[model samples]
Target: MKFTSLLKAATTVAFASVLIACGNSSSSSSSVTEVEFFSQKPEMQATLQEIVDDYNKSQDEVKVKLTSVPDAGTVLKTRIANGEAPDVINIYPQNADFKGWAADGQFVDLTDESDILGNLNEGAAEAYAVDSKIYNVPLTTNVSGIYYNKDAFDKLGIEVPKSLAEFQDIVKKIKDDGQTPFAEALGDPWTVNGFAQLAWIQSASSPQAANDYLRFSDKGAIKSDEVSKNVAAYLDLLAGNGQSNSDGALYADTVAVFSEGKALMMANGSWALTVIKQQKPDFEVGFFPMPGLTADAPTMTVGAADMAVSISAESKNVDASKDFVKYLSSTEAMQKYYDVDGSPTSVKGIDTEGKFEELADVADLAFTDQQAIWLHSEWTSEEIFWDVNVSYIKNKDLTAYTDALNTFFDTMK
Candidate 1:
C-alpha cells in the first residue's frame, strides 16, 4: 500500500474544546473564537499548546482548539477533501507538496504580511512560496550532519574523519576494535534513504550537481553521476561496518543503538541533540559535517525549515489565524520556540545562548559558507525519492538507483 494510504488508515479523529489555564486572560465583553490546530509530533503538539495557552491567557478574543493527529498528512488531506480542516495547520514540507497545494488555491497568500515573512530565511520563504506569494510562516530550521560518540571514538582511538576515504578507514578501525561503526534505521524508509542521498550530495564534484539531480532536469541527470557514486560508497560503508541489519533496523532500534552507545556515529539533524542529551547526559557527543567523497565538494550538508505554519484558505477566522501566525513569527514566540524545541533559528537576530551550541555552530557554518542544501523531501515527492534510496541500500545494487531516478524524472516530464 502507498504510504499515504497507510497513514490514512492509521489516523484517528480527536475532538476537544476544553480550556486550559496558562497565561491567557479572558474579558467579559469579548466573545470566544476557537481555532483548531493539527500537528503530528507529540513534542511539537506540547510546545504549540504551551504557546497557545500563553497566547490565550494574554487575550480573550481568540481561543485555540489544538488536536494531536499522529498521521497529520493523511488527516489533513481528508479534512481538506471533506472541507472540515483546521483553521491553522503545521505542514511538514516533506508530507505536503507546498507548490502543488498553493497552485490549487489551498492556502492563504501571506505576502501582505511581509513584516513577519521578512524575518525568515530567504530560501525557506521561496520554498513555501508560489507565484511570488508566500503561503506559510517558517517555524524552525534543521541541518543534517554526522553525530559521533566522542567517548566511543576515544576508547577506540579512532580520529574523526575529514574525507570519505578517511571516514571509511575510521569505521573499519572501530569495527576492528570491537565496536559498531554506524547506526542506520532501515525500517523507516525515510531514515535509511536520508543517509544515501546525503552521502550522494556530500560526494558530488560540486553543490550544483546535487541541486540539479534533485530537480531532475536534463542538466540534473548529467550531473547526477556523482550521486550514484556516493550511493555505492554508502552501501560499502554500511556493509563493512556491520551496521546493515538483515532484519532491517527500525527508527526506534537505531535510536536505541546510539543511545546505548553501541554505535559510534549516526547521521541525523540537529533536532536530535535534545533527545540524545536526555538519554545519555554525560555521553561525550561531538558533531562534524559529513565528509566529502571528493575534496572538491567541500563538506555539503542538508537543511530546511523544520516546520511551517499556514493559514487555511477556507478559514472562517482568517484574521484570527493571521494574528496567530504573526505572533508565531514574532521575536518573542520564535525565542520561546528555540528555547523549548532546541531547533536552529529560521528568524535572524535571536540570542541562542547556551542551547544546542554544537548545532548552532554547525548551522552558522553551513549558512555562512553556503554549504547547506535543503533536504530533497522539502521540494520533491517523498514516496519516490525515499523508496528509491531504501531499495538501493537493501539491495546494494546500482540498477534500482538508476531506474528510480529515471522513473521519477519521467513522471515529472
Candidate 2:
C-alpha cells in the first residue's frame, strides 16, 4: 500500500531522497553507527519503520533508518549502480539479480552466519540460497493463485474449478448472472504484471515449458506459439469480463471490488490476504491454484521468498547494518511483522497456527515439487516485461506483445 499510496500523494518525495539521506549517514556524527536501511516491500513500510525506530531508540551504538518508495526494485538498482548501496536492505535470494549481486559481492555472504540462520525454520533460509550458500534472512513465503468469494460461490452452487474448462464455464455462468467474473487490477501495471506472470505459469505444460515461454530466440515465436496464444487469450478473457472500470482499477480498487462481491474471483498472490481481511468482506475468501488445462495435471504455484532481509556487503556501517539485520530476525521483531503481514513465517519460534488457513490449499503446493517459482526468478531483465504485459492487456495486439518480448529477449542474450 505504501507503494500505491505514494502514487497519488499530494506531497512528493523521491527515491533520490533516500540515497541523499543514506549518502550522508556515514559522514554524520561518529557517536553512533548509521545503518541506512532500504526496503522493497512498501506495504510493510510502516511496520518496518516502527521496528527501526524501536531499534534506534533502544540503543545508541547503532541508528537504523529505513526508506521505502514506489517501484523500490528499480530504485534499488539505481542506488546500487550509483555505488550507494543501503547498509540494510531486502533481497530476494530466489531472484537472478540477487544471485548476481551476491556473486558480484553486493551482499554480505551469510552462508556462515549459522547462529543468525539457525533462527529460521528448517530449510527456510536455504531454500532461497544462491548455489547452496545462504545470503539473506527469508522471513515469509508467498504463493500465487485464484481467490474466490466463498459466499457468492455457495449462493450460486458453484464449486471450485478443477480444470481450465470448468473455470471457463464458471466464468460464463458468472457473466450470465450479470456480474463481473474477475476483479482485474489492470490499472496498476505492476499488479497486472503479477497477474500476467500467473497466467504464463498456468499456461505451461511443464516447468521447462514455463521457462521456455520467455526463452524466445525469434521475434514471431510468441505469436506463433499455441501455448503463448492461450496465455494471451486468457488475459483477454479476464479483462473482457473484468469490472467496468478495470482499466482504471488499482490493486486496491480490484481488491475492494472483489471484497464487496462485485466480482466472483480475483487473481493475486498471498499478499492480497491482508487487504481482503482489512475490507472485512461478508464472505470467506477461498483460494485455489490455477486449474490444470484439463484436470489431467493441476497448475503448480509460482512464488518465492516474500520478505527477505540482507545487509549490503559494501556498507560503510557494516557492524550497525548487521546489528539491524539481527534485530529484524529476532523473535519479537518477527512476530510484529507476521502480525500485520500474516504471511507464513519462515523464521523459527513464530507461532502461525491457523494464521493463514484460507491459503492452505496454495500452501500445499507452494515450495514443493508442485511449485514452479516465478519465471522472473531466474531472468536478468524480467521486470521490463511488466510493461509488455500491461500493453497486451490494453491493446490485445499479439504482434506488439511479441515484439516487446523479442526486444527484451535480445537484451538477455
For model 2, name the residue pairs that clash.
none
Give all TM-scores, in the order shown: 0.80, 0.78
- Please report the candidate that would top lDDT against the real structure: 2
Q: Mark the 10 consecutive residues where model 2 has the least summed lDDT.
A: 215-224
In candidate 1, list every pair of residues with a backbone clash.
23-57, 24-56, 24-57, 24-58, 25-57
lDDT of 2 by residue, 1-413 (tens): 89778775634466667778877875575567777888888888899888888888889888787888898999999988888888888867777878888878888888887667777767777777776777788877788888998888898889988877788889988888887899987777777655577677777776567667676444435554777787876677575778899877899999999999899898888888888889999888899887767788766677788788888888888777777777788888889898788776667787667777788788767546666667777677666787788778778887788788878866664
- Our tally of clashes for model 2 stands at 0
Off by over 4 Å in 1: 1-30, 94-96, 121-123, 155-159, 205-208, 214-227, 243-247, 365-380, 404-409
Instruction: For residues 179-220, write the lDDT of model 1, one tens digit per residue.
Output: 787777766776655465567576555445665665545622
Query: Highest TM-score among the candidates is held by which one?
Result: 1
lDDT of 2: 0.78
